[model samples]
Structures are given as C-alpha cells and as structure tokens.
Target: MRGIAAAGAYVPRFRLPAEELASAWGTSHASGIRRKAVPAVDEDALTMAVEAAERALSSDAVDRDELTLTAVATTTPPAEEGELLPRLVRALALPKSVETATVGGHTAAGAEALSRALDAEGPALVVVADCPEGDPAEGDHPLGAGAAAFVVDDDPSAPVTGTAWHTEETPGVRFRERGGEEVDSLGVTTYQRNAVREAVTDAVSSLPVDPADVDAAAVHQPDGRFPYRATADLPVSNEAVSAGTVVDRIGDAGAATVPLGLLAALDDADAALDGDAESDANAESDTDAESDADDAGDVENEPNGAGPSIAAFFGGGTAVAVAVEGGLAVEGIADLDGGATIDYVSYLRERGYVVDGEVAGGGAHVSLPNWRRSLDQRYRLVAGVCPECGSVSFPPEGACQSCRSRVEFTEFEAPRTGTVRALTVIGQGGAPPEFAELQQRDGAYAVAIVELDADAGRVRLPAQITDADPGDVAVGDEVRATVRRIYEQEGVPRYGVKFEPTA
Candidate 1:
C-alpha cells in the first residue's frame, strides 16, 4: 500500500499579476509568482485542505476506514491573524469513522503533522495545502491563491520514502507575537540563517542516506531562494527544482511554502509516477520527480502495479525536521492554466458590502489597504453578536448569543482594522491525497483573536493570518480583514473573509 499512488494540486482560481504585485512592493518579479493555492470567497483551511484532498482522492481510491485527517493553518505574511484548524477540519466530507485532528502553534507544526500521518495505521492518506496569510510582507500578492495535495497511503504503485530530519530551534530571527493591538516582526536575517543552517544540516546529516538518494527538496519558506542556499552543501541536484519559485515569482507562502514546494515538484513532474520514474529513476528524481507529458496522465501499474515512491519532507524552523512516507497520487482537480487580476474594491463590496478603513455620515468609507491596489476588493462583513446577551459575529445572523434577537441589526465590515486579540500556530493541514513525509521542518501557522478598530467596545473576533510567521504575531497590532477563500467545492469559488497584516 505504500508507493506514491496518485497526486493532485489545487491552485486557487484567482491569480494576481506580477505587474500588480511588483507595483505594490515597489519592486517585483516581472514574470509573476506562483503563490500557493488559496480557497476563494467561502473557503478556509479545512475546505482548501479538502479541495486538495478531494483531488488526491479523485485519482485514487481511499478506504473510508483508513482515512486519517490532520492539518496546519497559515496566513499571508504581513497581515497577521491566526490559524483555524478546528473550523476547517469539520468541512471535509471525511466519514464519521475517520480520525481527524488539528495541528498549530507555529509554522513548522506542519512537519509534526507529517510525522504523525506517516505513523498512521494501514494505508493512510495525507494532504498538505495552504492559504498563507497575505500581507505580513505581501508575499502572497503575486500568485497567492491555490492549494496542492499528496495522498500518503500504504499502496504499492507510488509510495513515499522518508529519510533523515532534525530540529533547528532559535528564538529571535522570526517571531509572531500577538499583543493587544498589533503584531511585531523581530525577524533578523543573520539569526534566521544561522538557525536554518543548523537545523537543515542536522536533518540532512542525520539522514546519512546519500544526498544523492534524496530527490530535490521543498523548504518551509515563502521564497524559493533560501532553500537553495540552505541546501547548498547538500547533494541536492538542480534537476529537481519546482516551477514558479516564490523567491523569483510569488514571494513567501509562509506555512504553505513547503507543501507548495512539493506541489511545484509534482506539477513540474506531473506524471512523476510513470514517465518521470522511467526517464529519471534515480538521478532526475533527486532533481525532478516527474513531468506532465500528456493529457489524462496515467502511470502504468508496476510489475505488481505498485506506483513510484516519493519522499515528501517537512522541515520547520524550530530546527526540527519530521519525515513521513506513504502512498497516493494527487493532482489539481481544476485547471491551473490561467491567472486573474485581483480587484479588491469590487471583490470586497461584491461580497455583500465591506468597509474597514474609515466611516462617514451614513456609510463606512472603504480605504483599501496599500496591498489592495493589486488585490482589489475588501470584505463586506456584518456584525452579528447576540442582540440580547452581546456576542460578536462576522456575518449578521438571525440568532443571538444572549437573546437570539432576529432584529437589532448593525451590520458592517470590520471596523478600522484591528489587532491580535489572541493567536496560535498551525501545523499539518490541507494536504495532497496519499501524502507521505515524516514531519515538516518546524513551522507554525498563526490564528489570532482579531479585535476590530471600530468602536464596538473593542470589536473582537477570530481570524487566520494571511502572510507572516506565528511567532512574529502579537496582540495590539493594527490589521484589516478581506475576502479570501472560505472554502470551495469541485473548483468553484467559495468565498468568505480573513485578515492580513497592515502597517
């Protein structure tokens, strides 16, 4: 039951142009970036994870008795918020018998999730995908919409082979401390590099398996360049690089980067199970796992019909690398062939009526965040707290927290941004079906209690940070929410809203 049986990738339907992103950043990768998949309108970490999981399952058969669900939630970099694993896991169509869990606290938690999945009983299905926060650093602006997945099972056609990994723990370089009103990024390059070197080296060295045996790698990162630098000394071959390196194109994907790296590898090598396996069994695999040779891509069952084996690894910044290996072939369930321009204004107001920046006499004024010039639209969120008891809800609801009041409406979008009311990291999340990897590099996706800047007695709510580090999150920071993928079904745009970092 253990070979990479099938694979799938999910790129959100929305695609931001390189020009737009570059314009916002004051500099850009003219060619554009391939940001990780993000759910649309109504999609969330759970739904995005499932979209990728469904794609992974579409290509293969997963035993209802054997499905084990695990996940990690991430946000865009600059816009700090929090990860919502609990909310997400429930969205999956997984059977009542299946076991499900949430992993968070740090970006690297994904690695830990990988490790757990690897140890699951029987043939297991592992899916990894992301919706990294968007603004922390605007890393997701260029191509920040989509999801990817791999199913790890015990099947033979395609299986995963895990090797060595280690921990590289450091306190400073990158931290997302959420205080009452804001998030602080005390990230120091020198410190990050020093720690990255230590953990990556330890993981690689511990493997003892020839660096040659290890195919190209995916690092826990938003940008693609750093991984190359970290593995410089390792025997990583160039042939195994993923397409749309973020460093050059999309930017950083936060918690989703590593999975995105794996997705990039899978996409670049569409049929990694068949054609790529044949053309580059040993060496090319180290560099390139497979290729998208034709439509209806299929890999012939091996002599035993067992598929090619893969070794998806997750290395977190905590200097910890967890390895998990299993089987399942997964790929995009929808077309990832197009890119779209984000219209935050239309996008936002279209979602009902979003207004977060300022207010006027009768209506709220929507002053798009600096990041929105490229990504048009803000979310039109309604305030739905219990009318009698006093509770806060994003979308206005008929029921109440205290008195279930159907009337007493004061609907509005997030007020004047907000701050981190509370936060936690995410690990293990939306994954490709049949994903097999030990543990991700130590990483954590953040989830935060967002308090609106509006005057509703410090409007507070929960949100997922779009594009920054969990450790870097803090309370009391200003932030604005926007419409992001709340979830999706068969590639349709399911919309909702989330928050991003704001200056």
Candidate 2:
C-alpha cells in the first residue's frame, strides 16, 4: 500500500489580516478570510518547501538510500530552469543519486505530484510550495503563501486504497504569460465554480470501486467557502468537509491547498480514532513532538487506523482525486502560530511588489566555488570538530580556531541555533540596497552577531534578524537559523541562513 507515510506543512510565521488590506485600500473585498499567511522578507517557495520536507522526514525515519524519486509542485518557482529538485534534495541532505522532477504551472499539479509518489515502488517525497502573487486591490484577497510536503513509500504513514484523475484543455479560465504574473478571467468566479464541481464529481465517479466509503473529504479551496460549495452535492457530508477546510485562516495557498487540507482531515480522523477529548492540547503536543524529533534526531512512529479519506484537487483545466486509507494521523503537522503579524505595507514590501530599487548585495558573481561547497556551507551547516581542543569551527579549515591546533577535524551538522550576543538596527539611510526594502517596510531592521550553542561546541556567527520588530529584539534573545534567499545574482537566487526569534 502506497500513501502518505509522513506529512508536513509550512505556514509562514507572519500574517496579513484582510482587515489590514481593507484598511490600506479603504475598500473591503467582501471575504470571509480574517487573515492570510505571509512569507518573511527572506522566504520564498524554495526555502518553505525545504522546511516542510524536513518536518515530514521527522515523522518518518526515511533513510536517504531508500528515497528513489522526488517531486516538487509549485506555481511560484524560485528559479526558471536548470534544476529545482536538486536544491531541495541537497537541502534535505539526500544522496546525489536520487532522481527528481518538477510539476508546475497549475495548482492541480500538487496532487498530481503526490499521486505520482503514491505510485512509485520505492520511497518518494512529494512537496508543494507556493507564494502566490496578485494585484493588491483585487487579486490579493484569495492568495496566501504556504507549503506542504508528504513522504510516500510502499508501506506509507498514510496508505492509499484508490485514486482517479481527469484533465482537459480548457484554455483561458486562468492564464499567465511566460515569466509573467498570473491573471484570472473576468468570469473566474463562475468558471471556477463550474469547473471545480464538474471535475471533482467526474473524478470521484471514475474510481473503480464504490466512492461512498469515504469517511472524510478534502477538496480544493480557493477561498474559505469554495470547498463547501463545490462538494455540496458530492457523496461527502458537511462534517467530513469541515475537517479539512482551513482556508478561513490561511487563505488560498495555491498548489499547497489540497495537500494541507488533506493533512487537516487526517488529523481530524486521527483525533476521532483516539477519542482525543483535548484536541487543542494534542495538536500542540504533536507539533512539539515533530519539532523535537527533528531537533534531536529521534523521530517517532505514531500510526493511525482511520477509515477512507478522499482528496480532490482542481486547477486551470485539470483535476486529480484520490481515496486513501490507514496510517493517516497528522496532528500538529499543520499547526502554525506564534507568527509575527505584519501590516499591509510590510506585506507588499516583502512580496517585492514595491521595491525600493535594484538590490546591490549578492553572492559571488562566479558560482563554481559556492556550488561546490554547498554541502558544507548551505545544507549541513557543517563545522569542524577539532579532536585536540574539542572546539568547533563554523567553516571547517586547516586549523582549529579556538586552540590554533594543526590537527585534523571531523565535520558534522553544526548547531544552526543560538543566542544574540550583539545586535544593531540599521535605519533606511544606512541600509544596503539588498535590505533597503526591509528598512522601508519598517523604519529599521536588526543585524545580529549570534553565539552558537550546540552539542558540538560554540561558534560565533554574523547574521540578519527576521520575523520580529527591531525594538523587541534584545541581546539575549534565542533564535534559530532558517534558510532564506539572500539575494539574486545574474538571475539566480542565492540562499543562506538567517536567524529568527524563537517563540
């Protein structure tokens, strides 16, 4: 049985309330969404996908050797061409031999990617990440940013029982120019209603066996209410649909919606099976468990005995559906809170809709050395462990920085977390071109010197502060390193680690 062995999601730790948008524009868009997730100034589809993949791997001890295929789905890809999957594969520290592919250009591709993983004979990871773009006044209300990841295996965490899909060339419902922003049809509302309803109905009916066995259902939600409307006449019930409907909080995270909704349904199914009376606490516990497992390298195996769960996805002219059974417990996997709230102006700055000017700072124009050293500097955060002095070096070198010993050293995953030993906030006039947008969003931004504290040893590292207000940050604040886009050089995004305050 192939299905989701492990599931994880990334909801950017920042929210832009609809009210904030309304306040900014002086006109409300008439929507049920209170707020939507917003990626940090440094975050994009690639970094968010990496985080979600790490979380999924934490729930299941997927050996690197077992993973044969990797699929990534996103409408908002960080880069246009060479290789999207390799970046994620390296970020996950997977072996170089792993085969990979990119499925994109539509939201339905996410489900298609997951379905491909389910069909694979060996272990596979399917990831969907999107940071959607839209016009602030009109298109922004329904677009939210998030990512979801799933690991598929012969014996999955969530086993699959049945599946179906349907596709047709229905052009112009939604379209985007090459290397351009997406634009929906003026008739988008009506077009989506009919397309989603028809596609979901047909896909469900095509399942070989009876489809009514579904106990829970997850359908594509463009907004808070679309799933309810689309599945009204389907075999599933309101209660079943309610379990997976999360757009009320996160908004429509294109390419991530179906996977995230499915995760919510699985969590609900798991809670019901356990008769979990304290759902809120259990969810929090589950989140902690996953995070702890990832931090400590001791992932737990918690199984589920839930009944069938039906997931459906519909995008421009395409739809995919599947019925899964067994191993579907995913509490806390999708829980996201403790996020910093940003105003509408900050949201626009972060999304790059309002840029101050061309960012000046970037990686080395020559990329060979950086590319070769990625495993050490970017992926593993590898540092030297000197045998003689027992001191760790941030960048492993010929000699130990602490004792000046010329002894050989072993390399391992360095502590990517630490405390801010020194901090300074640069005002807009003093900010570099790379950070001018951030300074413009907020009057000032902080730069920190962090002292790393890990099992290996301590090392001081210079970093930028994110996801918090300048005045709120202090010298002793605890923070964790997160991968983020430093800047783009020659049309390529340069990624590095940045620190954010811990909640």
TM-score, prediction 2: 0.87
Clashes of 1: 204
TM-score for each model: 0.56, 0.87
Q: For candidate 1, which ten residues in a row score worst on lDDT?
A: 433-442
Q: Name the best candidate (by TM-score).
A: 2
Superposition-based RMSD of candidate 2 using all C-alpha atoms, in angstroms: 6.2
Model 2, range 1-503, lDDT digits (tens) per residue?
A: 77777777788887887788888888755266667888876788999998888777776447756788889999888766755787788778887888787898888888878877876778898889997777667777668878888888877646677778888766666666787775454555776687778888888777654545454567888777787778866766565565566666677788887777777666533334444423432343253343233225421112221246678888878877887764454534544433567788878877767776555665235475665575456656778899998989877877789899887778887776789999998876787765555566545778899887778788777778877777899999999887777655556676767788885
Candidate 2, superposed: residue stretches over 4 Å from native = 26-30, 208-213, 268-306, 327-338, 357-368, 371-375, 441-443
Question: On a 0 to 100 scale, what is the lDDT of residue 224 in model 1?
Answer: 46
